[model samples]
Target: MAWLADAVVALVALLHVYILVLEMFLWDRPAGLRAFGQSLDAARASKVLAANQGLYNGFLAAGLLWGLWLGPAGFGVKVFFLACVAVAGLYGAATAARKILFVQTVPAAIGLALLFGARA
Candidate 1:
């Protein structure tokens, strides 16, 4: 059960890493533009902000990976990071796009559920 939870955590971390790359390095490129559904002019104008957001995503990934590295002892760390992801997802869903609920919130919620279930 714990392993499954950890796997989900790892996947979420990897997803964040991918998001980081897309936002930071490719925000104005075709792939990022397609993923974000923005015009080239809009993307270009927001590139700097996107990079900053990407850096935050990288930090979230780093925190999750760090928790994973600590094994069972990192339970609190994992929960904290997952909560952060959930909150961010909720905010993004409400303010930015509904897709964030599926992409970020759902996975984090599943991971959190598995984590708590494993403990029980």
Candidate 2:
């Protein structure tokens, strides 16, 4: 159970890192445009904003990784970072796209549940 929880947490972190890449390095490129459903002009116009968002995602990933590095004592850190991801996802779903709930929030929720359940 612990191993499974750890894997889920790592998966969530990797997803965030991927998001960071998409938003930061690829926002103005075809792949990012396609992913975000943005026109080239719109993507170009918002490149800086997307990069800022990407940096936030990177911070989330870093937090998750830091929690992982702390081993058994990292429960509170994991919960906090996972909650942040869940809230961000919820906000994005409301304002940007509903799929954000499933993409970002669901995974974090699952990871959270697994993390908690593993302690039982």
Clashes of each: 0, 0
1-120, model 2: which lDDT tens digit per residue? 988887888888999999999999999898898889999999999999999999999999999999899997988888899999999999999999999999999999998999999998
Q: lDDT, candidate 1, residue 114?
A: 93
TM-score of each: 0.99, 0.98
> Which residue pairs clash within candidate 2?
none
Ten-residue segment with the worst summed lDDT in candidate 2? 2-11
Candidate 1: pairs in clash? none
Residue 48, model 1, lDDT: 97
| lDDT of all predictions | 0.97, 0.93
Give per-residue lDDT, candidate 2, residue 47. 97
On lDDT, the candidate that comes out on top is 1
Candidate 1, residues 33-71, lDDT tens digits: the string is: 999999999999999999999999999999999999999
